[model samples]
Target: MSAVAESTAAFSAAASRELGEGTNDTPAIAALRSEAVALSSKKAWPDSRKERPWKYHNIATLDLGRYTPGMSASNGAAAGVRSCPVTGEHAAAIVLENSDVIFSEASPDGLDLIAFSALIDGRLQKLVDERLGSAVAAGTSKLTALHYAFLAGGVLVATAPNSEFKEPVRIVRNYSGGGQFAAPHTLIVTGANSRVHVVEECRSDEGDIVVMPAVEVLPGPGSVVRHTVVHRWGTNTKVYTEQRMVSERDSEFVSLQIVAGGGVVKGHLESSLVARGSSSELYGVTLGTGNQHADFFTTQDHVGPDTRSDLLFKSALRGHARSVYYGMTRVGLGARNADANQENRNLLLSDTARADSDPVLEILTSDVIRVSHGATAGPVDEEQLYYLQTRGIPYEAAEALLVRAFAGQVLDRVADEALRDELSAVLDARWDSPE
Candidate 1:
């Protein structure tokens, strides 16, 4: 293992000891937890002066230590907590509240589903042992390390080879009010020649809460997977999200992330094409208003020949809100005939609002077919606003129209019609009255 991984494994050991050992954990999981705990002791919240990831982040302004661990109670059992309204009869719903799985339903023939807390020792153990933490290796990031060391609970989902699901699997997680820390983990594996779809939603009630969520997706050879994530937390919530995926030979992966709520949110999304003939599309949308702050980091890695990847992320900022985006597209050595693209665009709606974008590309192979990255941050175009105003649109209405269109560029990519319409309406309501 590398020095960083060793440090994290050590931290996991110590943190897990103090965090309370779970008797349900199998030997491998227990060992993994120990390593994460060992690394946690040496790592602290990101420091603007010391960590590049936190350099543009205002860490000193946030009081994260005040949050306590989440209670092991389901929202259904708690008072004043509301369930998500976005549900369909055709979809399977898994509702997670705090550290408990409140509800889960899926067809046995469609998906092999199991809860992480339920895997003590058994057949699933071998698969979990091999795939867990394989994509985002331990110690890659401090927050990621902490997530592994102290994950609250999550589920594992897999589809049988050549099987198909007619409807999407919807996973909804709700965090309740209080200074609570909520950590949720998810692992998805799709078998060869199979197809799977998943839609995940994260929301919270009114309160000061901190949320830490991690997800890993593995698409087996010749598989196709589509996933969507929507985050809509209250103003007092701060969230750190980690999402990673590894695609195998001849597999295809598509993902879309929509961020619209939370006082402060930071996230990392990565797509790693680890085998030849793999392809992926990554898309994201961020809408910030008031004093909201949103930051997203992304990576597209081509580690095998004949791989292709593309990424597009858009952000709209109003009021004194702030937004930042940084991305990297890397082609590995000997990964010839690889093609990758990274693009980020930001729109500022007020003089006080600010946005920053950085897109980078690293091509390590001499025969890289094409690799490019571009970023742009600017205000609403005056010409376009003027054109709208001249056509009888009010100034504020015209600005809103353009802003909604800017964000819709990404929202429109969502393949689910219901989700797309719901998100579009929410986006309109959110930016209609920006400060």
Candidate 2:
């Protein structure tokens, strides 16, 4: 058999064993896992030379058989205190370790937060069945299929129609254990005219592990939703994330991604404005140090008339770190008067640091208002550094100041002051310490 075939066979066998050992799975979940395993078996492993999305990373080096699926000791029990860094009033908080819920609490408000394992027999079963994989399907890719096949530690957040929350919902996922495969999923569904914000943080222990996280957001008409994800994995961990948002008529969706640490982190973030007057904003900040590699693929999809989208992603790389960004803006034929913009900027702090950026636009409608994109990858300006030095500033401090300024453009856009400050502090620490 070919290498791809062997890898797929090994993964499928492992998933089958896991499924066989699982006795508490609901029928719906069992069916979902079975379908995912079957689909994954038929799909070949992604090849960088053949796939555009996988072009920047090679997965063939990973040993598919060396890692087993992770199991949680929680077993539907809640324990421990919340460890998320985002501090503020929260409507709900859910903490998961190794793809299992260890702690969860929801306020007396109308916001509904529950673990997926508990939702199987609850009143929300129908909702979960309908919206679980609506935004991102299991058949999307091999990695996604495997993610579903080994899905654990899943959470669902929903808002009632016309409801509004003054505080954000917090989610923290912690992964540990060497040579383990972890898959954590989050599903968000909002009713019409509702507004909410979600903050998610991911952390892992210092060991060799692989994580595949998937997030799906579905917003109702006239609703506003904002989501922020913070990634602080260990230097030995590899993470693959898939997050997407689909908006309704007259709705607004905003998303931000912060990458601070990881060995190899790659993700696909997409926003689909599917109804008239819908708008989306995407922002990303990444600090790559040591031998870290961060790769992001983003899409601004306009499927309705008068839709708007804006995206900005910035990264600062030091040591032998590298970063890659590939973004696409698509305006369909029915998307008349669509407005879209994409920008990517990278600052190289060392001669060995590297960055690759590509922004593309595909507009099928001639009545669009505006569509544009820009990308830049370069080192710090010598003139600026010289001027800062002339002002009696030390060379190291001057470079740090320039890097801070470069990252501040995107950080300044965050609406939450506390969260922004915390992220800024994390960035500063990451930039100062050598790998």
Q: Candidate 2: what lDDT?
A: 0.84
lDDT value, residue 213 of candidate 1: 84
User: Which stretches of model 2 miss by more than 4 angstroms?
Assistant: 1-10, 13-24, 73-88
C-alpha lDDT values of all predictions: 0.77, 0.84
lDDT of 1 by residue, 87-135 (tens): 6633456777777666666456757666676674465777777778777
TM-score against truth, every candidate: 0.88, 0.93
Instruction: Please provide, for model 2 over 328-392, each residue's C-alpha lDDT reduced to its tens digit, 9 standing for 90 to 100.
Output: 99999999999999999999989999999989999898999999999999999999999999999
Each candidate structure's count of clashing pairs: 14, 0
For model 2, the run of ten residues with the poorest summed lDDT: 73-82
Clashes of 1: 14
- What is the Å distance of residue 122 in model 1 from its true position? 3.9
